[model samples]
Target: MHKNDTLNPELKHAASTESGFTLVELVVALLVISVLAAGAYSRLANTDTQARLASLQSFKATVLSVAAMAKGMCISDPQCDIDQYQTTSSTTIEGKPILFTGRYPVGLAPHGAGGLDQLMMPGKFTIQPALSDTNRATYFLAGAHDERHCKLEYSITSAQSNPSVLSVTVDSSGC
Candidate 1:
């Protein structure tokens, strides 16, 4: 019955023992949670950026593949004219279905038989003659997804009995 003593032994024991978490423990837990939350937020913010970069990389690869195929065809026959197969739009490329002597190298996603429209970013690709005395053409591939737009430009030059020359450039920006 003293000021510090109670009739119930359990209550007295608990008061002296201190139950649940201490102030320092609570603060540490909160700090750990805040750190994890911040990491997750940063990763989410970078998701768009990662997608944009991947699109650019894929676009470049597709363009290069097409160019290589064209070069191979030209090599087989010195008279092979790539200009005959050149297209100004991806739609035309899609419509053609076949280039050189095989199916189109680029396939649209989900729709295996379709063209670049099935691509990850769903963009346009064009093969146009670049103004040059050499048999050189430029491949322009562009795609837009979310807040990013990626463009890849690749050029191929033909030379009889010689390896075809290739050049590529890429650009990706916010939409």
Candidate 2:
């Protein structure tokens, strides 16, 4: 064989084989990656609404628990009345010492219980006996962060038949 044509068939074939992706392949790969990235971003972006709704639900549960606990205590202990647990101001609920502040406790956990930490949004809480009747009470908790907002209303009535019945409503119009 001539000196210039020294390469074996296997060597020539290996040399001629392409080592990199074609332009179309690279473009398709990039497009796929971008689509995946956009999907991930969309999924992540939708979480805010879900989170706001969850916060509302959690706040509603907290309010309900507070009402239930107060009702149970009022029913059992003559000294601890439902009115004592009422919070008319802006303050965090501190268990035992002050009964309830802006928040309510679920268990024996100290201060700001009922998943208050989960309320990453700004909000308010209030508890008061119905002006019309002393045997009934109302609890209100609301949160708003930007366009996301939630409110929870809880009412407890003491009746001769049921003793205590809790009614709860959750509003997520802003969320």
Candidate 3:
């Protein structure tokens, strides 16, 4: 074995090279990181989606409640409007409430559609007049997400209404 040399510097270096991570160790590390990242990304996307949906639902409920309050006060028109309804806006929806945008008006529902991704997506909310003619104002809200990456949508309908929700859907394809 010593025929080539009494002492081999190359041999010493090779032995030292063997000190850190083995091939298997490196591969395993990579695999573990990949798995962790995948899991994290998935959770993040789902939670964000759910939160968005919840907010939409909350907004819907808020609209309904505010409408009821407005009704109780016997004021859906601009005549008996107050300060909050005229000046302040909702922080979550539009940064600032749309002024004179009646918090909730009969047949005055706002339509909202957008993508809500806290970590990696643009959070959007669309508010448009509801497409129904119910005396009680209704807001149609839709949280649009990366069709291939997120899931966020919530619908509101009266228990005594028609077309009894033939289908209600929620998805997280983006994940």
The best candidate by lDDT is: 2
**Candidate ordering by TM-score (highest first):** 2, 1, 3
Positional deviation of residue 154's Cα in model 1 after best superposition, in angstroms: 1.8
The clash count of every prediction, one per candidate, is 2, 2, 13
Off by over 4 Å in 2: 1-11, 79-149, 156-165
For candidate 3, lDDT tens digit of each residue in 1-175? 5664665889867876776878999999999999999999999877866776675555544444543543334234444354323221222222422212233222322334211111111234332334233122222334446532332233323243231121123343432
TM-score of each: 0.53, 0.53, 0.43
- Model 1 lDDT at residue 129: 33
Off by over 4 Å in 3: 1-18, 75-105, 108-130, 134-138, 142-175
* True-vs-predicted CA distance for residue 167, candidate 3, Å: 19
Tens-digit lDDT track for model 1 on 102-140? 212222212233233322233554443332112232334
True lDDT of residue 47, candidate 3? 85
